[model samples]
Target: MTRQVRRLAERTPPQRERYADLLRAVAITAVVIGHWLAIYVTRDGRGFQGGSILQVASWTRPLTWLFQVMPLFFLVGGFANAASLTSHLRRGGNAMGWVLGRTARLLRPTTMLLGGLAAAALTARGLGAEPALIGVAVWLASIPLWFLVAYVAVMVLTPPMYALHRRAGLAVPIILTVLVGGGDLARLVLNVPYAGQANFLLAWLAVHQLGFAWQDGRLPSRRSVALPMAAAGFAALVLLTVVGPYPVSMVGFGGERVRNTSPPTLALLALAVTQTGIALWMRGPGNRWLRRLGPWTVVVAINSMIMTLFLWHMTAVVIGVMLLYGTAVMPDAMPGSALWLLLRVPWLACLALVLALLVTLFGGFERRAGRWAASVGTVKGVWPTALTIAGVGAVLAGLLALALAGPGHHGPTGLPVRVLVAYFGGVAALGFVRRRYSRPARIAGR
Candidate 1:
């Protein structure tokens, strides 16, 4: 190993390995492509169609295996949380405060983006655009914001959840398995949304709990993680297609009666386990390559701006589409045929180029606030408090904006109100609770 790789390995926390960042980069890239294909591949000049793309790529259903990589993001999150919490406890720092500070840093840019989008929508409306078009734009724009809400919830709940990992031992996976099986049955018998919105805590949280296992060193040994993960993932896919009502698409299409993502089914959890295992297996080679890339500079640079990239990639696509409109180069209609899918290659390239430019220009959202700027760091126990306050304020402001401006108005509420509310509220609640319990640790001497 090179000096850099040796250093990284030495510094590697027990819970979070260097390979997890590589996994995150890969997962995010997959998400971008998956979203792009799901949107641009099956459109009819107005919106998406369920049948067209599915028929073209019957394999699209299995893309959920790749596309469901979002859970891996959370899995890494759990590992990071475990490591951070352990470090904080050892040093007599406030665990809650540490989580809050990090959570705040994560949430600040998201709130700003939502606020800006709301302003833009209002400006467009002021210019006398049609209500339907405005509504659609706002709704579409708000889609990426869901990750912010979900991530916050995971961070906030992680402390206690990590504790549970120690107590429950392997029973944790047993309970999750039961929930997965039971959830499917309930959805079938009840014919209700019970499995959809209701399992937000159960399903996705279950995946996050697996991350805790990784932290506690209770997960399978690094050398043996892959086989079980692949086996579990394959089994979940078979079960979902065979017995469950969930559609296999990771990205939502307009006409699918059941979305694998809306509540995240057993299939997604299994997929995470498989992906995590593969990621762990790849870590050794990956770390060597990452080190060879020189000084951790490139990886560190990308890590700094990941949030910005995630938030704006779709915006880049939107800009590309708009710029191409009203030209012969532009498609007269959205592509549905295999020929059109072939033709769309250049369009996809153009979209990627535009996204890169936008990110280059406006990616500062990922930067941490300097102490003088907003006091949002991990120092002095104040940063986390500030973060919690800001996050809560943002959610409240968003809710108030929704109530005052109505559902049709600009801001976070313009999306599915229930989802927005649930996500934001969950984040805020988690931050508050984490902070509350972590106070005593901060008071103790290091």
Candidate 2:
């Protein structure tokens, strides 16, 4: 593994933005570790239950500013998608084809995760696990999908958004940001129902548009730009949370009256801007640091299976909770208590071990999926493009349904009929398209 990483590092192009890769690696790592730390598990008479540390330690809410790194993911995603799409277009690829290729990488691994969780949920049911417990368990496991719902949508929109970026430059994000602000205002001040939902796309699209700027060199890594941008963003963030009715916690927990994240308020966008500025500020030194073989090797390795690690980290937590808390191997130290704090080291270590094993087991799927995606040729005509769009829409719709309605919502099979059909049908459609268009693999004789 080390040798492979070293080789990858050695072969990396000098023009590549290593800092962007580093930021992606850092963002996903932060999310995994942050989630593990935030989840507070305790065994109850009914079964094991989990809650967020933020609920118990209100002081910890403020720390979410540092830990809520989803903005960074979308930001980096925008950068990556813009780059990938441009390369594809330059190679004379169609927009739909590029969308299909990019989304295939994401959807492939996601399909595996949902399938695995469903099978596990069914097995637990056969063993007489309570339905409610199963539902909660599946819900917790699928929490990562909530972010994917937004990401996949934004990803699918990238081709069009990038086109807009080319024409409008910074004005695109500015308009999106204004719309996000209006959404927040409607939801908060007017108490309008579901109006803030627009920010789900607008806010993320806004952050993503910034990535386009960075990619095109419209947003530079200069002290003058970075300093004021960061300062103004930070100021807005403080003001919104402290005085403007938004919660201090950037991450949403159960039962929060107002969250910066769920619908994504202006406060969250402020964090995105703040993070964007900070990322730009670090680009100079960070890229230079990544030039070192050792650092670059580590970043390469992490980025290779970053999605797998993110998707399955919560499952590792669930497994650890079941094995330890279920069997009374883990002590019931109340969250925020001294003993709980002291036990965090071992707790984290145990979760890490479980996560490592899960990653080792499932990471191959991601690698193979990427290989498959790479092998497929671009779609040429209207029919194939339509097929690709329909397939992607079905997949996203199914994923959103599962995320909203737990996989265990229907009990024994662990998935609703429509959800299973929609998801698998989409995967099958994509598979068919790939097989039809795939370039033949090199053979021994060839």
Candidate 3:
């Protein structure tokens, strides 16, 4: 880790905005730790039962507002991608090539995760494990994959979105926020069943656009600007939850009739605004703190294993549950009990250790892929960039199918065969594709 951090720190350009990297690392790590904290697993002979603290304690719902970090991720993603795209254009890179490179980085660690789960399911089944148990394990382990689907879709759409950013500026997120409100109305007030789902794209896109505003200086970094923005967001969130139809939790915990996360309602947009405000407000102190080599080194090191951490985190939890909880090494106390709360410290420690080992083993793929230059690889015989899109499409389709199908020993290779094909085909496309500079790239000069 020290060697890796030294290398990364050496390559860090002095002008690079380190805060964005800090946010990215913080966001992804928080989510991983949050998952480990929320999920509770126990064994009943041959069966495994899992539930979250939210199922037991209702008062914790309000805490979701503080712990939910997905919005912050989209915000920072916008900041990073905007900078990256601008840099790519300055280097005479094509959009297709950019899409291919970004998708590959996102998908590389994902492939390992999916592949590992599939193999684990098969091995468990062949060992005479109950199908229901296998299914539960697989489903629980794969929960984090949902983020990749949304994130990849966003990455694929960046070029067009960036173009819109260039033209519309802050109006984009505002319009998106209004649309998200409309979506919530349709889903809750009018009973339009699937209307809320649209915000999955609309809300996040809006948040991403805010990142663009931050990047281009339209979103000012000042106490005067950020504090009011945060106050307004906090007010709106309270109104939406307390006075309006939205639930209190930013996440979809049990007992909530509506989930702010599943489709990410207008309330989440409000939460995003608040988080953005706070993040911007902290920029000055954060920037100064990060100027020191030691602090910046920690940020870079964490950022380096980020994808690995996000992808394998839940897997690590599952393994820890089976090895520790299943073997009775970690005692199970009632959910939300004093003992249960106390036990979680060790539980988290074990999960983190397992996760570290996973990263050490599988992180090589992520590191190698991360070091890849930001351009499409060129091939001699065919149009690889075209295939890049098709591949990404297949990968997305496959991931969606797998999530819909749910993981288990019920299908070929422990998952639906179609999903396997989609995933493998997509990975192949991105891996084999080639890059060719085009006039369009020059036209998009920074």
Candidate 4:
């Protein structure tokens, strides 16, 4: 690990923003820990049933305020994507090429996650595991995966959006945000079914645009500027949650009639803005601290495994619980009891150990994806465009299927049969795009 960190530190561009890496690490870590803390799995006489500390402990709803970190992700995503695209265009890169690169980077590790889960689900069934248990296991393991769909959707739109950014400056995000507010009105007030789904992109686009602002220096680092931004964001959030109908959670609570996160309500956007202000305020200090070797080394190492770690953290929890209970040594404590609370510390530690093992084994997919960035095809004109659209559409559709259906959900495992077919078909469609339509070297250079 030290050697890996040393190599990363050596290869890192001097002007590269270390703060982004730090933020990524911090965001993922907070999410992992928050999941461990908030999820309260209970074992009734009928094996394991999933529950949440938030359900039993209402005080923890406020904790979601601090722990909800998805906003930070889009904020950072917008920043990174803009900077990357701007640099790529200067080097004469094409839009399809950029899209292929980004999708591959995300999907490489994703293939491992989905593929492995399918295999595991199959094996459990072969070993005579019950379908209900399999369903719950697959569902909980996949909790982290839904984020990929939203992120990739936003990523696919980056080229045109960046163009819009170049022309309209900050107006693009403002317009998107206003649309989010409108969506909120439509969904909550008019009771429109699925109207809020639009904000899944619109709300995130708003935060992502701020990333553009941060990159171009339009978002000033002045405390006066940041403080007021924070204050206003905080104020709006209070109004929405306290005075209005929005839930206070930055994340969705199980069984809640209204969830701030599942569809992304206006209050969550308010939280994102507030977090953006705080992130900007702290950027300087964070960067300065990252200038040193030791701290930066940890950041580099963590960033290298970022995708693997995020994807597998929940799986680690499932693994830990199984090993502990399956062994029949550790007595199950009633959830929310003094002993149950006391056991959480050790439980988290065990979960971390398993997570480390998973990362060590699967983190290579991310590295391989980085090396395997490829252009879609040699075919020119709308042919390439058509293929790119089809490819992305197929992948999104497969992911949605997987998100909706658990892996190996087919009475027997063999592959999360439907999901495997969907996701693999999507990947093949993408691969077909690259092979069948790749730009020839001669014209690509031109």
Maximum-lDDT candidate? 2
Give Cα distance to truth, residue 214, candidate 2, Å.
0.4
Better of 1 and 4 by TM-score: 4
Error of 4 at 49 (Å): 1.5
lDDT, candidates in the order shown:
0.61, 0.84, 0.82, 0.80
Tens digits of per-residue lDDT, candidate 2, 45-81, equal 8667668999889989999999999999998999999
Worst 10 residues of 3 by lDDT: 373-382
Top model number, TM-score: 2
Residue 249, model 2: Cα distance from true site in angstroms: 0.5
Runs in model 4 deviating more than 4 A are 326-330, 374-380, 406-408, 414-417, 435-446
| lDDT for residue 110 in candidate 4, whole number 0-100 | 89
Please list all clashing residue pairs in model 2, or write none if there are none. Answer: none
lDDT tens string, model 1, 1-446?
A: 14543454456555445666766677787777777666643345675322235544556667666676887888777777787677766757654556555665666566555655656666777788656656656655555766655566667777677778889965776697667657766776677565545455566677777777876777754667766776777677667766765566665555666666656666666666677777666667886776544535445555556777787776665556567644566554544656556656777788788877766665565564212122221334565556555655565444334323322533333344543564367466645645453444435643
Q: On residues 103-192, what C-alpha lDDT tens digit does candidate 4 reach at each position?
A: 878888988998788789888888888887787787788878888878889988998988888889889878888898898888888998
Clash-forming residue pairs, model 1: none
Tell me how far the alpha carbon of residue 415 in candidate 2 is from the true structure, in angstroms, after superposition. 2.7
Q: Output the lDDT of residue 267, model 3.
A: 86
Residue pairs that clash (backbone atoms under 3 angstroms), model 3:
377-434, 377-435, 378-434, 378-435
TM-score of 1: 0.78
